[model samples]
Target: MKRNKFWLLGTLILTVTFILSACGNQNSSNSSNKQVLTVATSAEMATLSTTKYSDTTSLEALQNTFEGLYRFNSQNKPVLAGASKVSISSNKKVYTFTLRKNARWSNGDPVTAKDYVFAWRKMVDPTAASPNSQRFESIKNGVAIASGKMASTKLGIKALGTYKLQITLESPISYFSELMTGAPFYPQDEKIVKKYGNQYGTTAKKTVFNGPFVVTNWNGTNLKWNYVKNKKYWDKKAIKLQKVNVQVIKDASTAANLYKTNKLDYAMLTTDYIKQYQKTSGFHSKTIPLIGYMSFNTHRKTTANIHFRKAIAMAFNKESLVKNVLHTGSTLNGIVPKNFAYNTTTGDDYRKDAGNMLTYNLKEAKKQWAEARKELGKRKISIELLTSDTTDSKQIGEYLQSQLETNLPGLSVSLRSIPLKSRLAATTDYDFDIVYGTWQPDYADPVNFISDGGQYHLDDDYNNRNFRNLLNEAATKYATNPTKRWSTLIKAEKQLIKTDAFTAPVYQGGTAYLLKNKVKGLQLSPYGTVLFYRNVSIK
Candidate 1:
């Protein structure tokens, strides 16, 4: 799974517009009326294409507008959506799915099994340069196809007929069903994609929808758009709201004013407004399984030294960063957040099992810094820290700079605050000394955080053969042994954090927001699309 970065820049508000002039009957009952829900987000939608999007906001938009083989229910369990039936082979490596006959796109085209094959193949095609290509590495020939060693046509997905889909995996993934609920696994309309070519998914009119809603008024760069109900959806009757208007609001005060004036039904509160609204009836907070950490550019000589990385990690205090700077999250001891993954046998939280691998020790940090200086034969070292230009991120970056410089002698730290897109691009290009990033789980599994050859390892150029072998053993060797796989994953995490010190664990993410009492049925999950609006209704 790709690592997701969280930004606490601004507020997103959902405004409910009541249509009183439609009819007298509509005025009598709020539940029976057609309403327009106007919502605000901190950032604009990057893309609607399932194969290319990488942000949480884009995932939420895609989740509301597209249906996959399966969908997560309110309880965060996988439920059937596009596929009506499924069967697993005796070896559990092959999966056969039966597409719903009534499933139709917003353009009135029948959604067939061919759509799945085309989408999966296109995602793994090296030419596409998809950030999510690694998610399909479990499929047969997926690694080879992604690395350009083989043609995309050799991918292990096949459309048996118009409505039958067959997918062959190299190994049995325990969370394969939950993985299907992600947008990356959702099918794409090949005809629409070909017709639009390079312009596909750039705008609302350029794409087709198979879910309960279709996006509108988005011109690829605009900050406002709408999600209109898709009448052609197979289960359209279950959808309540007819239209949902979305906007990007970058100010917390503006969101507060909108909420106070009844212009907004739901608004995400920043730390500045959390205390002010905590006593209010609409205040809501959710602790998600998102962990913030700093990735070292191992390619750089200074950061490549394990002593230097350890010095930086131990110099700063995560407790102070979370309690004072962020004011919403909890301190993290490892890459995986607390209350996230549990031991399969003992049901113990992974954090409890891993113990405290990260700590604050000024003395040990000084010792590590001296060793690093001796190894590199340098009296002074300067490094740049990269972070998003969001209010919270800038604050965190500033705090880190102060803490490191104050704790370590002969150390100079510089902060580079860039927009989220630019920061992501820079991180991908390995253009910084140390970059602060976050990772949210795609599924409720430790492998999602510490997978072998996954985002965590590949992005930072941290190639510990033993670490990779441990993760590989857990996935393949102990494929059916739950206890063994659990122990192996714990070892891999230790190797990454304690042994190599490739990255520094910062804090876990927490979302604080306000929702009107009238809004109902909005489902929030810790993994995969944080927000679900399919069953949402505004009373």
Candidate 2:
């Protein structure tokens, strides 16, 4: 009986050992399958449609999962991505591109020339209700077609064959290639959209990717996306990192804690904490063009007063505001920020007249406030300063409230801290007297600064329409004749600055993010883009 019991025990031991060995192998396989990388930004990815919504968080996230025909390399210039070859006609009006033939979507559908043509056409289609469809107007006949003047067939793009794309434009744009490097020109698979109906791309699952990674998961607003390297990608063989993991980390303090615990690979710092991490062990900063401002409701009864407008502009000192609020030296002098590469051919200067315009002149500001007070019928100029209750916004508002009342006698300012979404809605609906805002450059050109900074009406959302109209006119003139356009845009920009004071140009900021040590060859453009995924890899 004792011998029989020993034999049974031996058998049980062997069984347990086998099970443990198998579990170990399974874990090893899963680990080998992934090369995870996470990025923690300040906000949630607002939308997956980068082309339709130009929101910063959306663009940053979509730039990774979706790709364009061309991508900017580490040198801050555009290089061919899916395109096999590129050529421009002698007149510089026509461009020809040959797409790589073997590329396929995440679902294995063959990506063809017509797929690109369909996507581009939809961008300019008026019925599409695209906010950024205005970008495609650069192509020949593109504006008229986008404006509903002609059928999209008249627009200048043609699929020469299954792998060829031809584009014609009205002007010789030196930045055309760079413009195509972003979502404004990224291709969308038409087959997936046709299959899904109105539900297409509403969630991460509904979307398809032709780029190096595809989003594998999302739960409505809470995104848990993972990227699996695309086997159908043209240069997929060169890809070293097989996977990417991104979790939504919205709070800056929480992100810092994650980094300290080694739970995060990369994270963004709050303005309050930037100084401490400026040169710390994991710190990495890159400066890109980012402009900040506070816009007023030009249509409001009190806000419509030109002197009232000018009072706000002169009330806040840009330098002190940046130093006090942002704690950075990025305070801006005028509307057109410094260091944005100037294209001189437009004859006259297009840069914002920062010198003579509103600078940090407290005495002058007090004088202007008195004049504005009289102009406003000595009504003790009081209005709501609409802004989100964000830590930065609230802090800035407190400072501004104190400064404005001290500088402008009889200026009674009421601080309103609304939710971020509410602030945005109110600004869109023209329900706010003054609100905090910023303008990000769409392209490298000066036109980006002048088109009311492209803060035009966003889909029936009420805005300073008259100011936007003036900006549009200036943009058109700049496109046709830059020199003349510069003069006109400057005049328009100044009209807001010197006249109605549509904005208090606070400070022009820049982009800065941390990168993991294991990640290699990650590059960001001066215009705020991460490009050339082909070379990015994990060590």
Put down candidate 2 lDDT per residue, 1-539, tens digits, no spaces.
Answer: 00000000010000000000011111233333234444443333445654454445455456666666787666767788878788989977799998887778878887777877887887788777565666775688776777688888877889899888898887766678777876767777887888875676667787888887766675446645555677767667666655565554434556666666665555555466566567767675544456666666666667766666666777776667766556553766566676674646733333433344666677777777667777667657778876555455566678778887887777788899754434554654677787765555656765555443534342232245565665566545345565665566666666556555555676666443444576666655455433334466544
Query: What is the C-alpha lDDT profile of model 1 across 262-331, one tens digit per residue?
Result: 7667776665666667777777776767777788878889999999999998999888877776667688
Model 2 C-alpha RMSD vs. true structure (Å) is 13.0
- Which candidate number has the best TM-score? 1
Worst 10 residues of 1 by lDDT: 8-17
Cα TM-score of candidate 2 = 0.80
Query: What overall lDDT goes with each candidate model?
Result: 0.76, 0.60
**Which candidate leads in lDDT?**
1
259 Cα displacement, candidate 2 (Å): 3.2
Which residue pairs collide, candidate 1?
none
If scored against the real structure, what TM-score would every candidate get? 0.90, 0.80
Give model 1's TM-score versus the native structure: 0.90
Any runs in candidate 1 off by more than 4 Å, and if so which? 1-33, 452-460
